[model samples]
Target chain A: MTESAAAPSGPGSTAASPEVRRNPVSTHPIASLLIGLLLLASIFFALYVPLYGRLTPKVGAWPFFYFYLLAFMPVMAVVLWVVTLLQRRFDTEAGGPR
Target chain B: MSHVNSTVFTIVVAVFILVTGIGFAASRWRRTQDMMHLNEWGLAGRGFGTFITWFLLGGDLYTAYTFIAVPALVYGSGSIGFYAVAYTIVAYPIAFIFLPRLWSVSHVHNYVTPADFIRGRYGSRGLALSAAVTGILATMPYIALQLVGIQAVLTVMGVGADTTNTYLKDVPLFVAFVVLAIYTYLSGLRAPAAIAFVKDTIIYVFVIVAVFYIPAKIGGWSHIFGAAQTHFTSTNPATGKPFGTFLPTTKKVGSTQLDFVTLALGSALALFMYPHVITGTLAARRRGAIKRNMSLLPAYSVVLALIALFGYMAVADPATVASVKKTGNAQLSVPYLFQNHFPSWFTGVAFSGIIIGALVPAAIMSIGAANLFTRNIFKEFFKPDATPRLETRVSQWASLVVKLGALYFAVELPKTFSINLQLLGGVWILQTFPMLVGGLYTRWFHRFALIPGWLAGMAYGTLAAYNTSSPTASHWASSSDIVFGFSLYIGISAFILNLAISVVLTLVLRAFKVPEGPDETLPRHFTVEATDTPAKERASVTAGEARPAPGV
Candidate 1:
């Protein structure tokens, strides 16, 4: 079953070349890199508690930690939107039909 | 059981009947000639637009467990429970990176389940079976948690007889479960997608109203926070430590900052790994729909942030606190708060919202687990020649069995056990990340290596979780444990071990010139759009491909 299924794709060795060309993120390298870094930074901001986990700076009733986490949601939405836009550029550059 | 509020009970029953009607009628929605295939039954025909996709994905991801459990956590602990908020926030960006690729690949290949994708990618039925088992295992506790949410609401409504017999006591829950099971069997994913509209509307209306009205009714947000801070800071006599910190503390003893960070990261990573979430993602019509929904879904998280504040509201209300304390179940915190603060009709609305919320996700989750069973297990092992009609029948029955198993867990086990098991579910599901997500970008990790890595992670996670105990319970007391004198989420720790082991073993396996499995997918397949009808594609594949090909 597996062998016949593998037959159409020829062999595993020949499969590598097309995979390299079609790598999604490699099409727009700089934009993908920036998007990757933005994703990391967003995660870092949310998780690095030492940076914002404090009570002194309170937004209304929210502590700094709570406010920071809640605020990051919108920021993340925007970051992800930008990433989507960048990926769209990559998609166009690669001449992939949407 | 003791005193049923006639108005609230009547309203809840009315709304529930309406929801059940919608659930059954959803089969006619987006009417298709063939509802026998996995795509129609499991993925709602894979043509959901942005609007329905948003509601379905939102409804699927944020279960009644989130509604009941997040606040319950905040009511019991303090700021650390806001890890849910942080997790949902970060989950989007992470999902944005991979979910579209997954959707595109699954669409192009007509893959019904993640395990199907894993099998095709790795050419290892054993690896795919492992993924299927983990998905089903993780989802059982999750479905159980939804029932726990419903049970909490029913207990608060005083619906069942206060008998010594457990069966009589849970008659209402049984009735609710039967309705959900029947509708799901009839309508499959469409039931949840159709009903998600009503569910999200009721939730958004009630939550928005409660956030505004409840705060004003209980002095203000400032007062709620003050009450919470005071309550959490006070010492518990049993533990001789502070109840919890109002803010996450840097100290080592309780609710440590590291625990908060790790829990958030671990949950974010685990959220998309759940088969149910992927089921929702794959139901969408296009990759762009998924990407758009990823950005838009955070709107639900904003609502979740406000919902978490209900814990603070409960803390502020002395009546709510006294009622929850009387029941000795912190899960009832939000319900008690609602019943105390809102009018009878509004209480009914909120309760119906929560009950229906549980129903929607529970249905979707069962479908997800059932798809895994039918596609990766039953079809893979038992009946390779199964027809699409047979496959759908098997999945429908598998969903019912999965739900019943979850019902048994919810009814028999202690409530805390189900909640802790849900945490353990997150841990168990994270073990699959390397195989599922790693296989997406690169097939470098050998499938053989991934199996052992997953086993090591699962074994280490279970043992670590078992070893950790608290004053209230022993064995699987919490999802966080002390690692090298710092508290960390057990999932992240286990994941680190899983990844490291897989990487090391992959190097070793390569050195030995092991036969890497045949790769059936091309890189272009991951970005493929739905140019032709899915049925046409499936037919073409069936005509061209070998009979034993894993994905349809």
Candidate 2:
């Protein structure tokens, strides 16, 4: 029933093929963490944010909750993207698939 | 221009054509020899890669209820709706722990459904039947809720009548659903799996654009928050009380912080128990895919967090409030917010996005429920020797029948109350947790014992939910109730009772040396990857043929 038909045939193993090793590369943790922290900081700054100068008129339809929730996507995406990288790193260092 | 402009009509037509085409094409996706097999039909050959899986699961988890309903709750009730946000946040991390294992065990054993696993593990057909019934019942209303979401979008777009009776006004919905049902029956799970990509793309783009554009139009973010604070903190003339906190001001707002935590925790435990979610997870090709995706899927929760905030944005915008008040339908809050602010063409785009969003999940939920009926109830009791083709046929018809059933509920039932029942669906689905999730790690609890516990939980959950009357309906009106001198999530309480019964019954059953069913899983099978072949082939197959889990 599974697509494991194309992979090496094994009854008990549910992992990727042996040669498919390293599980497609991902960005490293160092780069990931830097991006995440920076994004989080931006979100915090934006929170309770008031307009500054001529830009004082908040962009149209850009309400707080809408902005905040919408803003969460990319911020969380970067963080998750980083965590994914870090996890892949750990997975690799731990000797790839079991 | 009196009618929908050509562009609006064209967009709607395109969506309909594309969706219907996918539905038909899905019938042949992957072209399994046994097109009629439950695995092939209900679970889309159960071998989706990461990208497809992501889209499929997204479509499953995030529904039109999610886009329309969550924000509506935010628009209507304020902070209480954020429970959705919190629940979604925890759902993935919790699933990460058990789902991969469930997938592996199911994969190795060739289990078709969660109930199949329960029966194999505990050797109790009765308990499996209960799980099947609960899953079907919970999922039916959920499928119905998607129809309601579709109807809401359709009605708002003027695709339905201006003042027609609700049913006649729902013709557009009925038409779209008939098309959906046919395609689902014809194609099975593949249609939804393929369409999820389209659904998620539209939702992501629309939501992202709305989040940025809507805020800038509504005055700055601070001013929006300021308006919301001023509104919620103000005294309610009718209740003579403050409206509500944008965030929970008290741990015990209707539910204790413990209740909130327990509710979140209980729901996290229950998410994958919903047959559809499992259908999505198991449909994946690898256990690592399941594990890795769980970690990755939290990114959507961030999207969800934003979705929840749209309710607050509705509160802040005076024009938006005026539109919602004139409509007197809070369900229209998010849609009207867009209609009032966005250009007409973009509104059409947003409307289509929401409608498609509902359709993708509706297709999956129907398929999941159909699989449960076919595999667990129909096959187990009606025809043990039923062929894959027969099973697929039964499910296809059954999916159509179930959609019609949900349509009736959507049209006839009080929408708010049934939506509450969809929450009650959580309580129902959670009953299967101990048997399905617990059985994965340990067989300590006797299967028979677990059954009574599950029954007790179901009874108590149903009663507790029924007795929970709010301002509108009597009985089954609210999800919270007092238990053990504390307000708690009814699902958690019932789950505890269920577990207690299972534990006590297991102890009693063990003393009698009752025969337990044979477990198909080898111990190491739970921890390792399941290769395509049986253990016998390891010596003969190509290199890297997975060894049979040693020592089982």
Candidate 3:
């Protein structure tokens, strides 16, 4: 971390050499796409009220709407957890964390 | 005077003092050579780890408003109130996508406020000023809502409910706010970040116990849901209509399904834009800390989902209902339920939790607003040569002024008004989305075009909110109104209008070959890690924090 100060800094590198490290998105397109999908899915299940906003189906005494929201929390946590790991891997792979 | 629970009152006061002591002591927590820099005072030296970030953000986003107002809404209107739950659920993923980018950029550039980022990205002072002003304007009512939350707790404890004289009635609330303002001015962001630990612990203990114990006391989870279902389904004698839906439905005229979805989506987007939440995110030590915290912060939402059901629990316990009926304020439902069911000693623990919950967010918000004023408004426009010492001092005083303004809003406005004002705040802050969030990914938005887009959205949202009338109040009665046949949150509606105008005008401006402002940030700057930036450069970046790039 302390060695960053010694690294060639700023937009100057882009003009100086063709070997400049690209932005993370271009460097890891597949991982970036997967992260986007994971995020969008998390948001989708959450906001699509019709998917879980009902009462008939019950989980132990919770109405389905209530149960779904509670259950969705863990699912979201796991999904974002996966994305975080992927981001860590790519950040390291893309020239070792900037 | 109304009957005061001595046990509850004592514990509440004791907890208040404990946290107040903690707030002042926090300035020394991560000892630094100098406290005058905005980096130290306003951003807590930007060294918070993942655990502290989780608690700080949790304490920040799930506020006293979430505790008191959300349940009150649920108690009054049944399932529509759960939009808060849905809103919180979605806020993480949305923030997960944009916030890390913001964190990286701000760390690289030493941008202290969202408005600072706008100024750097667009190189437009007027647009940045608009962002700063909107942030401070939107945040006031939100701080006011926190005070109102504290007031609800006090009123239920019967501390001032007996007094007919208004001044006398407000003395406890006045004392509380003054204490909060003093510590916040003394310690800045550290005050709230420190107090958040104690506050969340107390809240977790009480909420979990209340969720389980209260259901057991009031007859089991099935009975509570059953009772709520039955009550919501029953007709109101005065209106000759059902109280509210037990579940959000697509069948109604002003369909709640659309309202639920829009409210959840709009609030999720707006939550991160609030300067305070941004302040919380920017305080972390590393960009990765924010993403890790995003997954972890939803733990608070599970607690929030349980808290919202306090409304249903209140419904199931008829004595609690009858008591709230006499007060004529549904915000008292949760407080009253705890007071009625829990032993007085335990009730004291819960009441203090709610009070401290209000204080933590209130402190962070004022600090957030103050940072915006110091960085974007004061330093940007008035004092370009302001020293870091001067900036921190100015921010301290600005925080006090912001808190005082919020106190006035809480004391003078109808108690119900703050909720809508907060939603109206969401309406106003979401207008900045195109400029702040949009500028992150693309510079295609013409700087000049964003101004009118923001103006149109703010004007339309304010007027729509002002003219909205409910059965009880003449104006500012609701946050949602009919927007093209669907009952949607006004913030979402205005955001669409804002985005459309920006896109249309950007095209025209591009066609005309108008000059785009200088962009200070490089492409890699948006993805730069803390470890990537040199410590010396990071320390010096604040010197030119608001200055535009030298050239394109």
Best by lDDT: 3
- Per-residue lDDT value at B206 in model 1: 96
Error of model 1, residue B355, in angstroms: 0.4
Better of 2 and 3 by lDDT: 3
User: What is the alpha-carbon lDDT for the whole of candidate 3?
Assistant: 0.87
Candidate 3 chain A: worst 10 consecutive residues by lDDT? A10-19
Q: Model 1 captures what fraction of native contacts?
A: 0.62
Report residue B465 deviation for candidate 3 (angstroms). Answer: 1.5
Query: Which candidate, 2 or 3, has the higher TM-score?
Result: 3
lDDT of 3 at B184: 84
Candidate DockQ scores, in order: 0.41, 0.15, 0.47
- Candidate 3, position B501, lDDT: 99
Clashing pairs in 1: B1-B158
Q: Give, for candidate 3 chain B, the lowest lDDT window spanning 10 residues.
A: B543-552
Q: After aligning candidate 3 to the native by TM-score, how far in Å is the CA of B501 from where it should be?
A: 0.1
Per-residue lDDT of candidate 3, residues B18-125 (tens digit): 998998898888968888888888989888999999989999998898899999999999999999899989999999888998997787777899998898888899
- Cα shift from native, residue A94, model 2 (Å): 9.3
Q: Tell me the tens digit of each residue's lDDT in model 2 across A10-44.
A: 46444544333432224245644554554445333
By TM-score rank, best first, the candidates go 3, 1, 2
